[model samples]
Target chain A: MYGGGYIHDDQKKKPEMQAEDPVLLAEFEARIARGEKIEPRDWMPADYRRQLIRMIEQHAHSEIIGALPEGTWITRAPGFRRKLALMAKVQDEVGHAQLLYSAAETLGKSREDMINDLINGKSKYSNVFNYPAKTWADVAVIGFLIDAAAIVNQVANSKGSYGPYCRALERICYEESFHLKQGHSVFVYLATGTPTQRAMVQDALNRWWQPIMHFFGPSDKMSQHTETLMRWKVKMASNDDMRQQFLSMYVPKIWEIGLTLPDPNLKKNPETNQWEFTEPDWNEFYEVIKGNGPCNAERLAVRRASEERGAWVRAALKRADQHYVTPLA
Target chain B: MNIQSLDPRITRLGIDAEEKNPDQTLQREEHWETYQVFHQKKRGEKHSSVGVVHAPNAEMALLFAKEQYARRGETVNLWIVNTRDVLAMNYDDYDVFSTTPEKMYRDPAGYKVNDKIAAYKKAQLDV
Candidate 1:
């Protein structure tokens, strides 16, 4: 249910474009251009496979890690009904991670490798999860706004060129509609409740504003790398475009509920038809991404412990005759 | 330096905030092999391939599949097959079926006897 608009690529060294067989490369490009999906066994350029693996793997990690903050609230949800709904939402988030991991697996990275990379601090998830959900209102804001932002990203990605990823996203998006509705219900209730409740939601909104702004990552530098990824349908929309789409879709909803965003500068430019606001501190965003955020250590530690503690049960279930096989999509 | 989490449950775990564990890696098959899942929306409907789940056995795979695929949907039944069991043709070999559509003799739409019968009826009327 949680994803960001940006995916990170290692910047230390640009990938050396190996001279692929021109014939195969053209056919691959043509297939993409014709809007045909690239399947698991199809011939593709090495760069295309590498980029997709990275993007989908990061997305998978985001869904799993994103569950932790909201998961903290399940035991303390305001009522029995809210508790049930929150539990369902958390379970769906985990299920989404599994689906995404499987999608990335079709590109040849195993789920184990992806999990190891996550817990060992070798990969990144959605940066927004690094911040803590300080109150029940925080959960509402996340479910309502964060999920809204993610839907914008996921909807675009469902139309991407990879068959397995697209199929998984199609199903994921369908389930996400419920997440959005439930989230909005909670959000509206809190916003329109007693003065204390209203203030709590407003305070949560102020704290979460920056992270939401940073959710899509910084404005992308239109580079040659980005152009190629777009042509390949790997990068579906620019980060800024998604951020604008999020603001346009959700800001009025927030205002209509009498909640104010932290930014006084937030407005739509009449001429350009774009959202303008004080840019979120990109320095802080990068720092959090570098594993320095408030919840970064706690998230990884919990994840690591889960894997370690579950080892015995996994071992007990293992059959001596078992052999690993790549899944067919 | 224990993590003083706002969530009392996390705080109760008493995890060291500064503890840096060695690199954790899972061995191959640690999560076990994958099973492809087929889900039927309702009775009498054919089960269609949904996705895969990694588990230790078919029973666990099916359990995982229900949690993953049938979470919010109408489902009467589910089937789990080991990924190893299903044989599939490679996409590279897809061209083998490329010319099948052009074989008009095998197509029902290729038949034109109605037009010939109509022409014969018209000619008989003219005579």
Candidate 2:
């Protein structure tokens, strides 16, 4: 559910696409045009398969890593009910990772490789997690605003042409409804509470605003590559459009609570009906992706340590007759 | 340096901040094999294919299945099968069933004898 919708391919030099059988490529495009879901075993173009594996794999990794930030708040949640709800939310995030991993697995990468890539930081997740959730109110900002942004991305992706990814998103979007509601509950409680509580929530919003603005990545440069991806149904909505959608839907809700976003220039343009705001620093975003962000090292370190710690249990359960087979949808 | 965090649990884990896990790549089948999960939402409903989960054995597969598929829904039952055991038809062979729908001979609605009976009564009345 935390997939940011914008896929970051090292596009400094776009790889020349492999020449697929023209007839097969045509048929594949035709099927997509007909609104048919492309199943795992179907003949897809090489670029289509590659883009999908990357997109879905990155999405899956986001779900897993996305849990860590929220998981930080579980033990410290204010009440018993809040603790239980946070526990369930964290569990749901992990489960979402599993669903997404299987969806990517249908494209032929093994689960181990995906995990390896994630822990090694070869793959990128949603960049927002690189920041620390410093307080209880930070968790509220994340749960409400961050989850809301992810829902915008995920709901659009559920309509995508890949069958398994679409199916996974369908289930994920269902569960994310609860996450958004719980987040709103926490946010509202803080925003409408004592002056100290409102200040805490407002401070959290100030810190998260930039990261949330950077969530969908930089406005996508309209290139032939992006067009091809869109035509293939690999990339559904443009990053800018999805960002606009998120701002339109949630900005009002945030304003209604009398909470101000950190950006003074953030306002809907009554003339064009598009929300305009000062552009977030794209340089910082790229730097964070390069592993210089505040919490990136800790996040990967913890993940690697968990893998190391769990090795014994997995080794114990290793069966002599076990064999790996690609999952069928 | 040890990792520092707002969450005390992570801080207390005392992990070396710069620890490089050089040999942490999971071996093939290290996570075990996949099982295709079938979920029945309610009693008397047919079990439908939900998704796949990896586990060491059938029991573990079922456990993971419940966690993955039945977490939020009203799942009355679940079935897990080894992915290798499933013999599936290729998309290439989808044409095998393509002409089947066009036949219409297999459909109960295809047998429209009422039209012929009505035609016979009309002819009798004309005579």
Summed backbone clashes in each candidate are 0, 0
Real A-B contacts recovered, model 2: 0.89
Off by over 4 Å in 2: B124-127
Q: What is the TM-score of chain A alone in each candidate?
A: 0.99, 0.99
Residue-level lDDT of model 2, residues A1-329, one tens digit each, is 79996687886655789999999999999999999999999999988999999999988888888888898888889999999999999899999999999999999999999999989888888899999998999889998989999999999999999999999999999999999999999999999999999999999999999999999989888888899988888889999999999999999999998999888899999999999999999999999998999889888999899888899999999999999899997
Docking class of 1: medium
lDDT of 1 by residue, A1-329 (tens): 68788786668765787779999999999999999999998998999999889889999999999898988788799999999999999899999999999999988999999999999988899999989999999989999999999999999999999999999999889888988999999999999999999999999999999999999989998998889989999889999999999999999999998889989899999999999999899999989989999889899998887787798899999999998888887
On a 0 to 1 TM-score scale, where does candidate 2 land against the true structure? 0.98
DockQ of each: 0.76, 0.86
- In TM-score terms, candidate 1 sits at 0.98
lDDT of 1 at A78: 99
